[model samples]
Target: MTEKVIALDIGNVCIGIHPERCFGALGFRSLADIPREVLFLAGERFERGEISEAEFLDGFRRLTGSALSDAELRRAFCAIIGEPVPGMAELVSGLAGRGYRPVFFSDTSVTHMEELRRKFPAASAVPDGIYSYRVHAKKPELPMFEAFEARFGVPAFYFDDRAELIEGARKHGWNAHRFVSAEEVDKILG
Candidate 1:
């Protein structure tokens, strides 16, 4: 019998994230105050570990034209991380107890990853994962899928909130689904 593996995304799947919180903390009136394209470009580099935390903070300051200190920036950055999706921790633990391996596969930066592990039970529950900062790639990118396949092989079930990411996993031959809620996941996998 083959081992059953479950791939999970962190943001919006395991934990709820609000970018507006981070922006507001940084003194932006709203998310619209920031340029989406530039923010994503900087964020992608940060998530890919191509830039150091200091460099990312500097980029953020430049982008936002804020004079906040590094500590303030770090706090604001982490403010984006919200509460864990309710019941995800129990769901992951139940899956593990039932002989399925649950692993986190997320496009995340070092700071956010640290905060998630520290603050969220669901994140701490599954110790094994393929992180974008560690893998130097994000979802929908072939390298990310290849890394997952290399580590855990195929035929795994993946849950994420993004359609493109689901399509990417399907293209790589993994079973993928759009995550609705923990109850939905429990029903499907139970």
Candidate 2:
């Protein structure tokens, strides 16, 4: 039998992420305090590896007019990453034991990815990954889906917290689901 391929999103699906924590760590009281250019444009560019890490930090400082040092900026940015989702590591192992090849499909920056790998076992459990930084495209984009199809031949199933990303996977002819909880994934996989 052909091995079943399953794509799992890393951010909110495998590891909990709280962007508010990052903003708070950076001394922002509310989301409104962050500029759209810094939050969206610079972030997306960083995730896509269009800019170097140093450049991203420089842009952030220039845009926000903050006095944070490079190390402080990195720490604040990585603060968004939390612990791995409960039971997600075991679920990943279970998927492997059940003959499902689990792979990470995510849009994440280098700093966030490094933090996740260092802190979350589940985030590193899956050996295979197709990241936006490497792919040069983010989710909800055609290029990401195309890259997945080109590499893995269209995943048998894809799970993500975002409905828009799920729709993107579906458009690529994959069975995609909005990930809610590990229990929901267990039921679906079983």
Q: Which candidate is the best by lDDT?
A: 2
TM-score, cand. 2: 0.94
lDDT of 2 by residue, 1-190 (tens): 5679999999889999888998999999888889999986446899998988899999999998999999999999999999888878789877867888888899998888899888877554577888898889998888888887788878888999998888877877789999989999999988
The Cα RMSD of model 2 versus the native structure comes to 1.4
Residue 6 of model 2, lDDT score:
94
Q: What C-alpha lDDT do the candidate models reach, one value each?
A: 0.85, 0.86
Quick one: how many clashes does candidate 2 have? Answer: 0
- Tell me the deviation in Å of residue 187 in model 2: 1.1
Misplaced by over 4 Å in model 2 are none
Per-residue lDDT tens digits of candidate 1, residues 15-38? 999999987887778877887754
Superposition error at 171 for model 2 (Å): 2.1
For residue 168, give model 1's deviation from the true position in Å.
Answer: 1.6
Give, for candidate 1, the lowest lDDT window spanning 10 residues.
34-43
Instruction: State model 2's lDDT.
Output: 0.86
